[model samples]
Target: MAFREMFSKNHRTTDAAPPASTETGRDDTSFYDLKHKIHGRLIEETNLAALDSMDPAEIKTEVGGVVEYFLQEEQALLNEEEKRQLIVEVLNELMGLGPIEPFLKDPTISDILCNTYKDIFVERFGLLEKTSARFIDNAHLMNIIDRIISRVGRRIDESSPMVDARLPDGSRVNAIIPPLAIDGPILSIRRFAVNPLKMQDLVNYRTLTPQIAEFLAGCVKAKLNIMISGGTGAGKTTLLNILSGFIPANERIVTIEDSAELQMQQPHVVRLETRPASIEGTGTVTQRDLVRNSLRMRPDRIIIGEVRGAESFDMLQAMNTGHEGSLTTIHANTPRDSLTRLESMILMTGTNLPESAMRFMLSSALDLIIQSTRLTDGTRKVTAISEVVGMEGEVITLQDIFVFEKKGVDKDGKVLGRFMATGIRPKFADRLELAGIEVPEDLFSIDRYYE
Candidate 1:
């Protein structure tokens, strides 16, 4: 059945129908039918291989001409505005992400999620809303997915039903097809901002106060090792990028990630990305390998994008040896949980180090943990700035330098809270002073919140 016909029977009174459905009933039905007819004709008439080699502008012009000719030939009833829109949609189908192109262009949309051919959702302001966009069918969605993965030198089929890739614009994409995906092919795209979020931008969004930001900048300047901890989508990587900006421009920094996402403006920076196994299941490079190799590159600082496994051990070793001002992120809810996660990841290396020794290593290496959280209201906040003082026996001790205390949610469900200093001065104050980074004395005043 045609897309319009599939929904035609369910239509109530014209006034009750959604604006899109009502619009479709009025003229969109004819538009889709005309679009379908023109698409078939174009497929049969155009030289797709030759068209691929032509410049994009030329291809668009040729396609536009064909669309105009088809409209005239078929005597399709379309107004000027409808014809223009149809042209754009047809061109998008030919060269872009089709139905999802508009969402990709929407700067406010942070994520595009496709659960099935007809079920499409977009996340805006941390809330998911169903979109009017959809695929024609399962086969149509799979074709788009195949095209996306193929561009990145990857493939997904029965042999390989799952793949992770990125768009040309650096948005992270993950797709899983059946039999792995029982519901249908699943595609999730985490869009990257065209203008990367800076520290001031984050402050404006109330992710962290300026005082904590200044403290973090000072820690980075003083060559302290920092780990950002958070759950998925909690803005951990974003904070890592902002903190990295504090590094001196003259220092050489090395960044390693599974997929390169960090946009560092530093002139002396080296970025490394891991490689997935080839079709023959050979020549895969893991993050652990990158971390181990970064040591010999004589980097003044090393930034692991995130320590998911054995790489955590190597990252700690780098910190314990000589590399300071190093930064990384991990998946955890709290500062303490971050340490536990690190300990678990270190064991994945098969190091067989005693628990006491591992705790001691963690305590010695990590100077601070900045815990980020996405609260119920969908606002991300840096909930804790914890200093890893040292090992108290087998336990790694931590003291909060700053914390976000929740009062209550307002009537509109907005979270009401304040970021307050813990009054306890950080052990690194002396070190920071020695490094010529002067933090204000009143910044740590008891119960005081930086307005």
Candidate 2:
């Protein structure tokens, strides 16, 4: 018998109702078999090579016709809605991200994590939950991974085994397979928001108070070098993007990242991304290389996505050498940890300077450290905003201008806290005034609390 005829015969034989105990198991197996068969038939019967040359709309129309013909010829038992859903899924498998396309389209889903072909999860509103999405098998999952990385001129195979890539819409994707990913092909996608959040949106989200936002805007406008510190997924990049909006449109800005995710609204912005080595293990571009190159570009401000290594030294140098208003992020739990992390990253540069000299350079180069935190309640908040006062003795002194004090957790598991001004005015206030920016004195009044 032909392929379609044989498939239909087997499907019909298994279509008979089974005993109660085995009914659910049989049904699941039958569905997987049917889906697999249909997917195979679509691949075999359709002229995918020709479809590739067509526009997206044309390809969808052509693929829909093929699916309709197959459904009719196979005489499959499915309702209209079921058949329509099947066509969409088949099209997704053909031209778009197969199983996770729905999650990518979902605005509320912030992350899509595929642990294996059979296991998948998504994060919505800061909480992770398992999703029904899955690949047919390991081979199926590998095909999708290849498709994603290849689009960005990158690859993942036994030779490399790991890669980072971006979707057409700028969503970040990381994949590891085989020897590196013993479980199976592992993929993690950090979806970029279709609608990027603004400073006012963050204020409404209670990430920070309006007063804190205002102060940050003033600091940015006054050209103070600011460093944002937080743990992973603590909203550091989001806050950096917001602060970047404060830069005047007239001044030029340079942004550097391993993957370009920052969305700057300023017109005079130049974005740079680091290049990984080619398959032959040549042509690698490091972040430190980009930072040193950015200085010669005459940038009014330089924004590093996150300084994780030797680039930290160049970033501090940029700030000390007249590149004011530079914004960057680092992975650390607190403001103090952020400073320590910077010192360690600078040390990674193999500089022979003593720790004291590094501390002095950090204190002089960075004027503010905005600390973000992800609380137990799944809400992100700016826990502390400190001014990097000049060195006192051998230690780098910092004065907290605003802090989030935790009172308790509510019955609903929500964090109960208030953002309060510590009463100690920032030394940069005079600098802000000198730059023709005026912030109300009461904005920093002692014991002032915002609930």
Candidate 3:
């Protein structure tokens, strides 16, 4: 069966968003300042627990009363429409993170960035667009940051100037303050899907073709060790999650990540996340720690969100020792750079192993390297899928099985490219066959290309 036919049934999530506000003129500094003040008064007067249980309609009615009284007392001139906008802002502050709540709810927005109180930007459709969202001041931004981190059992203060957290919805968050941030608090959120992307969605977006997806699904079934390589925001984790969908549901997969972003749907999967150091500068758990411990858990497959540090050695150890269908992602501009980074990370363990020995070990463990790239035009594509054909001397060898050939840009500035087979049959084709998966000759035909 095709990749979509197999997995598309359970991959559904609501892609719809409630109607966005078309309200104008309220996106100014003065309006945010007044909204902040009224929110302060509402906090003092209104019962937060009661409001939390109230629906949006009830909350609107309750907030309208408090906001109207404050508007009258402060003599802030506003018409009915402006009052309604002000009420929404106040409710946002009370109910969720101020100014950013709307962007968090936006399905099209992949990232939410706060440079400072005076400036905020969001990544919409792989491009950064500045939003009119603002906090009253740096303190207000810091307060929002604190609320976010606190919910995750993490904190940010003068003693510890940086933190990594996630929202209630599992979006990745990073925040830095004064000494580290220099200007003001810097906040970044990496959003994931409420309903994760499926193979059909990737094919629809042209990230990959059905042929490539079918081949990757076969690789997963054959228990090939796969590493996804890409630069930042290149959809590495998203591909990881999609590839993970190909794993047999009966396997007890163990996933490790610093921020815990992978949404594995397998029934028997075990998810693990690293813990940051406490305020006392102790009680911290690293990815390396989890990788070492996951061994005792008898995982059928080990899925790492990414291998960036000394943990690379342990991850390689797991791959070499019966954890065959393991998957991981790494930050590199290309497939070759991923091996280089892995070698450096292994050396980080201070092991005196020779370079050739390490290369041999890496070559033996990895089966394929899939490269994901975000084009200049904000579209993401799987640029290359290379197979490790083992070492041919001191160096680990890699060959491209499939690649995306970029053919410049269109008049509308969208990227134009074709995903083509390299015509070279991978060594793992035999393994797929042995696993009862067919190896179609046309899958490796170089003459045919997908647009």
CA-lDDT, candidates in order = 0.85, 0.86, 0.87
Model 1 clash pairs? none
Q: Pick by TM-score: which candidate is best?
A: 3
**Of candidates 3 and 2, the better by lDDT:** 3
lDDT of 2 by residue, 75-138 (tens): 5556678767777788788778898999999998988999989989998887789987788899
Better of 1 and 2 by lDDT: 2
Decreasing lDDT order of the candidates: 3, 2, 1
In model 3, which regions exceed 4 Å deviation?
A: 1-29
Candidate 1 TM-score over all chains jointly: 0.90
**What tens-digit string does per-residue lDDT give for candidate 1 at 140-255?**
78988988888878888877788888888778889999999998999998888888888899899998888788778889999999999999888888788888988999999999
Q: Which residue pairs collide in model 3, if any?
A: none
State how far residue 351 of model 2 sits from its true place (Å). Answer: 1.1
* Model 1 Cα shift for residue 442 (angstroms): 0.8
Error at 85, model 1, angstroms: 2.1
RMSD to the hidden true structure, all candidates: 7.7, 5.2, 10.4
TM-score of each: 0.90, 0.91, 0.92
